[model samples]
Target: MIQRPLYINKLLGFKDKQLIKIVTGIRRCGKSTLFEMYQEELLKKGVFKQQIQSINLEDPLYRDLINWEKLYDYINAHLVDDKMNYVFIDEIQNVADFQKAADGLFIKKNVDLYLTGSNSNIQSGQWATLLSGRYVQIHVFPLSFKEYSSALSSDNKFEKFKQYLENSSFPYVLNLNNDKKQIYDYLGGIYSTVVLKDVIANKKIRDINRLESVIKFMTDNIGNISSIKKISDTMVSEGLKILPVTIENYINALCDSYILYKANRYDVKGKRLLKTLDKYYLVDIGLRYYLLGNTKTDKGRILENIIYLELLRRGYNVYVGKNGDKEIDFIAESIDGTEYYQVAETVRDPLTLKRELSSLDLVRDHNPKFLLTQDFEPNTSHNGIKQINIIDWLLE
Candidate 1:
């Protein structure tokens, strides 16, 4: 079990706190592993084995806990009087009225609770209303480039790193030998489960076929601007009767499932986020390769997707830079008011380099405006902007 310091730090902060520790993300994205790490911490800290109870509601062994009362009874029976108790629940959403169970455990003076789910629709109003201001929600994503490199302990680091970029940062794929077919098959399984279980099973949807089509379209157009009107038009051309509102609803369902990511357009010239169209990025890149064969078409956009996820992992509020007529791949600003970045595939050609640099020039602010590329060369500085190799930046 490799330690994820980022998540560990968040978990450690909640030690013995009254607030419920909630970790959410797409399925198989290391939520359960983090819980295991936390359990180890408790044991090392001299927490009695009996004081800690971790239950996976998804397991068939817990079938009797189909409702809140059964769950409450099981947890209440384990509670020790006048002693601090640690409770960890995995896939808590599987239990009906999960909020009630969570609330019951939370109100007990001796219990410190932790819960995790693949989606946020676990308990609608009660979790927020009852536990309001008492719980902290931490989002966990797949491995970052730094985490990915650490996972691959190979002598040939660059080769392994390249494979990580191509394959993905999914935790399960780390054990599977770098076979392209097997990696994608694993990604497809995760995708299907998220779609069927999280989206279709939980949400109100009239047509599963149309929902799947919309998801395919979103995946194919990762990093490109999209609109409901455009989607409706495309479906009409394909002879599929899909309404614009229906397309919008399906998109919402996909987002709810944590399968698709949507980025709103920020007009740099206007200095605000625009409402017309938005770009979409998948939670993992390997899934795109699986669903839409290995095509060299749109490698630039795909590279953009990779950089986008990396920026997010680094704790930056990322957006597309729109400087008058020029467009920057990314405009990342950290919350601490420290860092900023602008990514592009390559700036080898003078005209292309100028186009990339031009976007940074418009933002006269003195923060870092880096131009990331695939080219291997010395990091260059032009007009107060720095240009470096994207791979090298990821390593740093």
Candidate 2:
């Protein structure tokens, strides 16, 4: 099994804490695997096998314990007297009023509770209200480029990255050995589960065709600024009469399901967020190849999508920055301060290089600036801004 030290280290840090550890992400992004790995680590640290009680609600063996009361009683009955019990409940949302059971389990001084969910609702509404100030969420994402590269025997990172983009990054696809047909079928299964079970059924959305149209438009325009009215207008012109309100609902559902992520625009001069023309990025780029065939793609935008997700993995609040008329590709803010980024496929030409650097010039701030590209020359510095290869940056 591939080791995810990034997430595993996080779980280790929160081990045996009073807070309920909730791991969340899109479906098939390896939440279950992460739990299994962390459980193994617990055993390594002398956590006894008998003290660890794992119940996967999705498993048919636990079907009878679907109700919140029954689930609570079942786990409560298995508690090891006077010893710390590591209770892992997978897909806790399968039970109605699961927070009741979670709360019951949490109050026990000996129970170290861990839960996993595939949708955002696990932390919203009733769950959030009941578990307020009592939980710490550890969000899991699909394998990063570094993690993906670790699983391969070859040292050819550039080739592996190309394969990572074309083939799906949903973890299981790596086991298929880069077969096109197998990857297609695997990604299709994930798409259906996330759209049908997570988005449609969970949100009670009825129009599958219209929902798909919106998905296609958003997927095709990754890294581009868009709005509900613009999406509605475009679909109407294409003969699908979707209202802007319906489109907004669909977008919300998509985001809630973790199939898409929205990055709002930030006004650099005003130092505030803008409410218009927000950009959407897919959780996985291979899904884009699966939805739209492997035709010609915009390399620049694809690189931007990769960098955007990487910034998120590094724990930064990323946004598109508008400085007067020029738009900076990303403005990542964290406790350290604000950092600026500009991503492009290549800046080999002087004119292209100058155009990319101009936006950073407008920032007029002491915060670090970066220009990431695929062109691999010696890492150079234009003024104070650093220019590094995108692949090198990912490995870092």
Candidate 3:
């Protein structure tokens, strides 16, 4: 196992907290593996195997325990009272009224609860409304470049990183051989499962054609600003009659599925989110490449997408930095409201470097501002703004 320390660190903090450990992510993005990793940690810390009630809800053996009452009975019968009982439920969203079971379990002080789900529609009633502030949601993503490299052979690290950019960050794809067809098939399966779990199961979206069209349109216009109206218009132009409201619902479903992320354009000078346009970034680039059948077009924008996800993984509130009229690729702020970053693919041209650096200078705040690019230059202070390579910045 690659041992994702970044996530494990968060899990360690989740130990014995009164709040439920809710891990959410796209399907097949290693939620089950993360559960296993956390389980091992608990055992290493002297937790008895008998006290840990680990259940894979998707397994057919648990078919009889589909409802909350049956699940409660099943878990209650297996409860060991000698120590703090740890409950691990994978894909808990599959069970109806799971919140009742979860909230009911938390009433017992000796139980530590951890639940995993592939979607946000996690039984909306009492568990969420009643246990509002009592739960911590941990969002997990596909493998980062760092994690992907760790799983590959040493000799092919760089080549594998490039392959990762082309294929995806999904862990299973990395374990398999780097065959293009195999990667596409694997990612396709992931996409299918996410659509089924988050879209079909949670949201009763019957128009598969319209939803798939919206996905294609969004993927094709990765870095471009788009709206539901624009998507609806484009579909009509292509001889498809879909309502703007339907398009909005489909896009919302995709967002809930964690397949596409929307970057609402923020006006840094005005300090507000713009209403008209927003950019969409696919959860993984490999899926984009698999759909497009090319990884070379608009490489800069693709690199920008990579930077966006990395900033998110690094616990930053990222936005497209708008400096008056100029557009800075990113304006990343840490969770504590400290630190900021500006990412760009290259500053090869003098004008490009000057333009990129100028955006950072526009922000009068004396916080950490950096311009990340592909150029092999060390930190160059341009009018008090630091310029660094994207690779070095990411590794940092």
Best-performing candidate as measured by lDDT: 2
Candidate 2, position 290, lDDT: 90
In model 2, residue pairs whose N, Cα or C atoms come closer than 3 Å (at least 3 residues apart or on different chains), thus clashing, are: none
TM-score of candidate 3 to 2 decimals = 0.94
Local accuracy by lDDT, each model: 0.79, 0.90, 0.79
Report the C-alpha lDDT of model 3 over 260-322, residue by residue, as the tens digit: 887877788798878877888888998887667774567777887888888888878777766
Candidate No. with top TM-score: 2
* Clash totals, every prediction: 0, 0, 1
The CA lDDT at 114 in model 1 is 95
**C-alpha RMSD of candidate 1:** 2.2
Of 1 and 2, which scores higher on lDDT?
Answer: 2
Indicate the TM-score of model 2: 0.97
**Model 3 C-alpha RMSD to native:** 2.1
Q: Model 3, stretches more than 4 Å misplaced? A: 123-127, 155-157, 338-340
Of 1 and 2, which scores higher on TM-score? 2
